[model samples]
Target: MPSESFVASRLTSGNRLFPTVVEVTDSAVIRRRRTLFSRSEESIHLQRIASVRIETGLIWSDLIIESTGGSDPITSHGHHKADAVRIRDLVTAAQTAHLPAATEAGPSRACPFCAETIKLTARVCRFCNREV
Candidate 1:
């Protein structure tokens, strides 16, 4: 069996260091298996993988796997629990950075008499014809 450190290194490497085969079942579950240099084989179950992209190199194998599921497989430097925590943190960070913030930012304006909300750029309220 390959050492845990070796497995982790292969996984975290941005470039494809292993040949990965992803199997997607009818139920949308994904099973990812990677064989590195024919010496190490690691498998990870990713709940739902919508798509996969693989880049093969002459000398090194590069694989990138994306999942549409709620979370990704956890990789840790320590125990399994630590790996879970690390994965959760990584997922959370990715989600936080993935979302686009609202383009418009300003105080919300409501007509005093009509109780209608109006956009900051709006000259008149669509719901109630109130000049801002």
Candidate 2:
């Protein structure tokens, strides 16, 4: 379903004002309205996320979403603590649900002799040259 799970902005005049919003969705985390000069949205797929970090303040919080690819983390500042927490939890759950290839469920089996990945019908471990 469509969602407006969070809106983070630069707070001014001691009040909450949302100039931009971070959208949480089933498959992606999107930050819309990045600049006035151009319409740009940053979207991070759930499968690529490495971690979601929240830094809390007295009245506001910041979120840093890191990727597994070693690129720069997406940062959203001036979010409410509850909003930040919700975003963190949502991202974490999505990341766990959408794991990468190394952790993906498959038909391959582990070789008992060398603990290497092997086909289900394999009789020998190719990497270790041992009987499976």
Candidate 3:
């Protein structure tokens, strides 16, 4: 899936020069911060994200994305409340989409046409080269 970006509002403190940008994608969340002399970025994979915390103010919101590895959390503030919420939602949706499928259905099954053992999730038979 395509990535969605949220930028902190410049009106808030510490963002008057270069606002922070947060990007959420199917595989990871990235935060980009810029300064007069340098730029920095932080990223956490979807599977490694532990939680998302949002602190809402009257107008803007703060976002904190914690990692399961006990590393530093990715944080950005001064974003619109709606954008902050959307970022959390997108992270949740992406994590769910990235989860591995259950194997309770069985690992392998016989292909009806080829009578060959194949993965349960396979749509085509490798032995017969036909759709199953």
Candidate 4:
């Protein structure tokens, strides 16, 4: 997937001088904040992301991206509501794209009735179409 960048509105507080920019890519979500002297960046891998929260006000929205590792979340304010939602959607899509591989890593066992290998979580035997 192509990387997308969303910049917070300049009119909002703390963004009048330098707005925050968030970039969403296939693998990660990155937030970049710039000041006069120093620039700061934070990122969370798509697979590690636990949640994406959006607080929408009348004009702008605040976005929070949390990870499963219990670290500080990446937050960006002054974004348009639509932009915030798009960010969340992109993250969800990226995470779900990797879900099947993650799920397929679980253990498998032989189906007693059919003597065929099947996922441990499966209740039916694939080879004989019988309840395992």
lDDT of each: 0.40, 0.75, 0.93, 0.94
lDDT of 3: 0.93
Cα lDDT tens digits for candidate 2, 1-132: 355568664672212443557888988888765453566678787777888899887887877888887777787778888988888788777666666547544578988877788888777788788877
Question: Sorted by lDDT, highest first, which candidate order results?
Answer: 4, 3, 2, 1
State the lDDT of candidate 4 residue by residue for 1-132, as single tens digits. 999999999999999889999999999999999999999999999999999999999999999999999999999999999999999999999888888755445799998987778889898788989887
On TM-score, the candidate that comes out on top is: 4
RMSD list, candidates in order: 13.9, 5.4, 10.3, 6.3
lDDT of 3 by residue, 21-55 (tens): 99998889999999999999999998999999999
For candidate 1, give the lDDT: 0.40
Best by lDDT: 4
Number of colliding residue pairs in model 1: 1
Q: Tell me the spans in candidate 4 whose CA falls farther than 4 Å from its real position.
A: 101-132
Clashes of each: 1, 0, 0, 0
TM-score of 4: 0.76
